[model samples]
Every structure is written in structure tokens, then in C-alpha cells.
Target: MTTTGTEIPGPAGLPLLGSMLDLKRDSLGTYLHAQREHGDVVRITAGPPGLRVEIYGVFSAEGAQQVLATESANFRKDNPFYEEVRQSFGNGLLTSQDTDYLRQRRLVQPLFTRRRVDGYAASITDETSAMLATWRNAPDATVDVAAETTRLTLRAVARILFGVDVESAVDVVQRSFPIIGEYTLTRGYSPANFPRSWPTPANRRATAAMDELYAECDRIIEKRRADGDAAMGEDLLTLLTHAESDEDTPLDASEVRDQVLVFLLAGHETTATSLAFALHLLARHPEEQTRAREEVVRVLADGRVPGAADLDALPYLTKVLKEAMRLYPAGPVVGRQAVAASEIDGHTIPAGATVVVAPWVTHRHPRYWDEPERFDPERFTPEREKARPRYAWFPFGGGPRACIGQHFSMLESVLALAMILQEYELEAVDVEVPVSTGITLRAAGPARCVLRPVGRGTGPA
Candidate 1:
């Protein structure tokens, strides 16, 4: 904590081919155009014999809450981009380390606290009205609507994490969790990067689909602990079979099947890529999808859908799901490791470098946004999002290694945006096709729309 009166300045780079070839030609708009010619903090590398290390670009949200929470003992998601995603998300607790990720984040942080995610808001409004009754609209009706909002939040996180629906082996666990998001992240730092075997069809279909999805979660955790069903259905695999730690030891079956495959690959790809970028930004903003369909019929008029007392009466559908996670941010580049030799603003980051806390380049930081590539969802109301800069707006990342399904991906993205604004009306069908980052931020494909029906008394008459 000694970064005194400026003298840092290490921008203009070269090193073993630093500035990572303009960050591999346009990763989050070339690192926000080198943060407008290097300001916040910048230094790059990825050279060596392979995937080098060292990067800082903090972009102050209190310097990302002092490196993910008060310089948490000198920055650390604990190395090499969370050890290349804990080699296929095995160590789980989002790739563990220190004290085995602080004892599995305090035994799975009381099943996502906030009163157990407001008791799963009536199973996320009954799995978003059974996925808006298969979105019908007649005349050659269609609906990919981002693969049915990621199969209705992966069948409501497989009924709140294993009460049911291992859905006939979910396509061998969704074709093996995108082979850890198409590895090649900086061409893998040769711990023997394997690409030779059987023409790599995404690493031979994720080694033949995570070996039958870990033998069907090890026979449903050995028939839910041999019929004792571990104090029965409290979901989340019965709260990790009543968690324990502080030497009280528990969690074994291969560390609870790698923490249930990190809550089934981050509980259905970050709420199905934030409800498919909030239905492709409310089908290209038809006046903010008619003010989120008149606040979902002025707060579920009587057709009764969103409960948990209508999630505080839909604050404009929670600002259109926090401006569609501030324009699509499902784990957009987040890596860490510095456990020694630190120096942010003035740049050093020596000890085991490799850092990249990018929330897609600190949520479009034009020194706290203005027309930051507009899609202006009234800049997240609440007085224009308190004029920006709370870490500019991290998606689901912050302290104590954030994102333990951040409130079950924010009430499954506000119960699938109030069951698709309580039965459709999204007009404009082709505006939002921009985003590209793979392992989460989607829509380089099916964003197509057209789900009219808001007729009968035109909602909230």
C-alpha cells in the first residue's frame, strides 16, 4: 500500500512482444483502446516460450475494491487465469486455492444467503411460466429466443440444483462445458497443451463429454447417500449434504463432484447469458420494450407471476436486468495472481504475474462512461446509476472472490425478466447482434425476435 505521488508511468511498451499484439487484436475493444492511451494502469505481455504474464489496467472502482477487496494480501485469484479454469472446473468453488478457496467459500455461503435467494422466488416464477409457454405467435411461429433462454435457466438450475431433472443426461453436460470455454486462452502456457488427439473436435467432445457428466454426478451422489437422502430435498444437493469445514471435514466424493461441476457450469452459463442478453435487449428497444411491457402489466396485475412479493414490484425490471448486465458480461475475462511483488498504479506486478480483472475492460470506462458505445437503457435509472463508477459496474464480481451464483444469478435474471414481460410485445427484430465473447456473453447467432401479444386491454389498461 505504498503507491505514493506518481512516478509510475510504464505505458509505451515493447517487451518480448508485449501490448499482446494489441491484446490479440480487439479483446474488449482492444483493452478499451488502451484505456484511452494508457491512464488507469497498463502493462502487457504474453510472450515467453508461451502465454506470458503481467497486466494491471485497474480502472478504479476504488481500484476494483483494492484488487478484489482491499488488496486481499496482494492480489490473487491465485495464478494463471485461475489455473486455466481449475483444469476443466474440477477444483470447483470457481477454481479454488488458498485454504482450498476459503473452505469452499464458507461452506457455500449459506446457500446464497439473501434469505436463501428469497426462497428461489417461487422456483423463479415456476421456471418462468414454463418458459413463456413455448413462446407462440402463430403465422409460422418461431422461437430460438436464445435457445429458449438457455433452456429456461437450464431447467431452473436443474430444479434448484438437483431435486430433479438431470434431464436425461443434459447432452452429456452441455457438450462438456465448452471445453473450458475453448481453452486456447492465450494459447495455453504449455503445461503440455494437447491439441493432437482425434482432430480436436473441441478437444474430442470434451473428452467424451466430461465422462458421462462425471458418471451422472457419481450416480446422484451415490443414490443421495444410499437413500438416507441426506436429510432430504433442501436442494443445492441438499445444501452440499449439510456442509462443514474448519477441520470438521466433509465434502469428499471427489470434493462434492467438483462442487457439482461448479454449480453446473456456473449455473447454466450465467443465467443463460443473462436471459439471452435480456431478449436481445428487449428486441432492440421498442421504447424499452414498451417500458418493459408496462412494468409487466403494472406488476403482474392479477395473472400472478412474479412473487417474492413481486420482487419489490419490478423496479423497471430491475433496470432492464441491470442494463442487460451492462451490455452483456457473463464472466468476460477475469483472471488474477500476484501473491507477491505488487505495484498497481506505478506498475510492477512481479510475483507470478498474469492478471486481468476485465469486466469487459472495466465496464466501458470512458473515465466513467458518457456515450460509452450507447444502448442507453436510461443508464440504469436510480438517478442515472449514481453517475457511474462503483467499479464502473462489475457484472458479478467483487470481494471474497465474488459470484457464488450472485443471488442465483440475480433471481434468474429477474425471473426471466418477469416471464418475458408477462407474455411478449417485443417488436423490432434485428438490432442487437453485436456481442461476441464466447463462454458467456452470447448473440453472435440467434437473437431473432417477434413475440407480439400484449393485446387484451393492452396491459395495465
Candidate 2:
């Protein structure tokens, strides 16, 4: 039983299907429009009769904090999208609930500490250098930064995750993730979807991709087990293999495979989205780009590639990435199911309602962000950051459920951006990158930039 407060406001919809068409047509735009038009909390209804779905949109930063942190116990990863992902992938950290989540978190926490992730910086630098080398060799001066960054982040994370087995893992991941992402998105949003056993084209493709991905991860895990201590190394896979060493029981073969699959999905995709958009944003703003490059060049004055130690020294570059993530968060909308009724902004949210905290909308809230659409890096300066609410600029979702790989993501982004800016001046060819939300945010079209080589001597340093 819950006390009734103010009636929750929302957009009126058609007779049977509410805003489903509008959402399916333009999900991000619809969310933004709802927040702007309907204050902070807006109800969105889809489906009809027995199956009507009501999604409570929490747009204010305060509301976001309540849902994700302050009243986190009231919410869990029990939404449709999470269920879709959990079924396709396994029950990893991203979708595990309660005790299972706690156990997984405890086992995996040590591997992602700042000190441990810092050790992977060399692998990141090597991969960044290789990516740059590919750009230099490309016949076309204009390259799609979105595709390039996806390839780069995937390879880098794969190498760190699989060690010697990265080669076999890379191609499968690259080819299968897009199929899986699309399938997840399409089915996750539809008010009604066909059964997997029905064997539609989409189902066949998604099923095949899932099988391929699982098979590959199992193969890698089996090989690592066969190699034993004689070939054990410091890669993520090795650490996971021994994850249970500290506890009473070890992670089983399926558990190891599930964790690896989640890592490959979350590790590469989110960071790749951030890097691509950061470069695109910089390319569009040459003055900001110049300032960022100057900072990078000055910090790495010795001309050595930036490692994890140098991350703090390049503050402006870090700000640039932060600002980009603010404008275009990779995980635009995070969903949770309410276990009990809760109040947000004087409104009573009924129990069993689906709730969403959109970083994409909250990051652009009119109250906290001045000129929310403007590209500004100074907004992230230390003094200014402290002045704002903690949840206001959450590119990574907040609370205990916050991204485990955040340090690694930042390390990869800042290092790769520094190295790339050191060698080339980027100019955008396609100024606007139309994006859509899948399992993560994705560029619907090409984000192409023309790269002009620059001399090290000519840099600000």
C-alpha cells in the first residue's frame, strides 16, 4: 500500500498504443521532449488492455539520485531491456540481481582497481599506436572515426582481456556484437515481439550470433584452463580464472565465460562510443581542439606516449572527453523496475512501475547546465564540478552499480586522444552524426574526419 500524492503528469497517447510509435520513431527526441514539456517525472504508456506498460521517466538530477542511489533498494535490474540482455548474454554484473550480483561484484572488484587497470596502459598505448599506423596507411584521407574507434577499443580491450588469445577472439566479437546489439534493441522496445523459436530472419541472425559469441568465449576459457599456471599471465582472463582463489569456491566454466562476454560487451562498446564522439566534438570545435592538443603536447613534452601516470597531467584533454560524454552519453537511458512505491518530486510512483533515469536528459537539464546544447569543456573544471550536484553530470551511472570499468575507460580515452592529437590535426567532414540508442548509443551514419599529419616540432610544447 502506498500513499497518494500529486497525480503524475504525462503525454497523452492514442487509444491502444500510447507513445510507442513516437518512441520507436525517435526515442531520444521523445524523451527530451517529454522532460521539457512535462516537468521532471512523466508517465509513458505503451501497449493496451491487459498488457499496458507505464514507464515513469525521472529526468531531474535529484530524481536520478533517488532512483539510482538514495532509494536504490526500491529499484532493480528487472526491466524488459535488461531481461533481453540477460537472456542473450549471461547473468553477468550488468544484469545480475541481489546475492548473485553481490557475489559477482566481490569476486570481480579486485581486478578493476585503479592500480590493476593502470597496468593495462601499455597495452592501450600499443593498440593506439597500431590504430594510428592504420590511419597513416589508409588510401583515403577522410576516415570514419566512429568505425575506427570501435575497432581500436575492441582490439585493445580484447588484448587486455584475452592476452595471447586475442587474435581468435577479435573477429568474432567485431562481427557479432552489432547483430546482437540491434536484435536486443529491436526486441527490447517492441510492445510485442515474436518468440525466438519462431525462426524469423532476425531471430535466426541473433540466435546464430549468440551461439558464435558463446562458443568463442568458451573456447578461450577452455584454453586458459588447459594452459594452467605454466602459462598463466596478468591478463583479465587469467585473473578471472583465479577469481575464486580468494573465496571458498571458484568461478565455474560457464561463470567465467559469462563474465568475459560481459566484459567484452561493456568494456569496449562504452569506451568506443565516448572516444568517437569526443574526437567528433573536438573536430567540430577547432579552438577547443587546439587548446586540448596544447595541453596534451605540454604534458607529454618528452614525446613519450601517454601512460596511466600521465592521465592527471592532461586535465584539459580529460575535460574534453567529459564534456563530450555529457552531450552524448553512451548508455543514454538506464532502466530499473520499482519493487515498491516511491515518491519523486512530490509525486507518488506506484509499486511495480518501470522507471528510467536518462543521463542523456539529466546531463542537459536546464537548471544545472547553461546553454545545455553548447560544447564547453570548462564546465568540467574542478571548481565548477564541485559546485554542481554529484548526479548532475553522471556519464557513468552512480551508486554501487556504477560502471566497474570506469577507470579503464578514462585511461583508454585520455591516452588514445593524447596520442592521436600529437600526430594529426582533425577536421570534421560530416559535421552531424545521427545517433540511435541500441544496447548502447550508436552513430546511425558515418562520423568521418579528415586527418592532416602535423610535425612534433610545430606543437605548442
TM-scores, one per candidate: 0.35, 0.96
Per-model lDDT: 0.68, 0.89
Report the lDDT of model 1 for residue 6. Answer: 30
Tens digit of per-residue lDDT, candidate 1, span 356-453: 66777667776666766666767787776787756788888888777877766777787677777777666545564666665456666766666666
**Residue pairs with clashing backbones, model 1:** 54-354
- Model 2 has an lDDT value of 0.89
Please list the Cα RMSD from the true structure of every candidate, rounded to 1 decimal place: 19.1, 2.5
Per-residue lDDT of candidate 2, residues 84-184 (tens digit):
99988889998898988888989999999999999999999999999998888665667899999999999999999999889989999988988998898
Error of 2 at 270 (Å): 0.6
Question: Lowest lDDT 10-mer window, candidate 2?
Answer: 1-10
> Distance (Å) between predicted and true CA of 193, model 2?
2.7
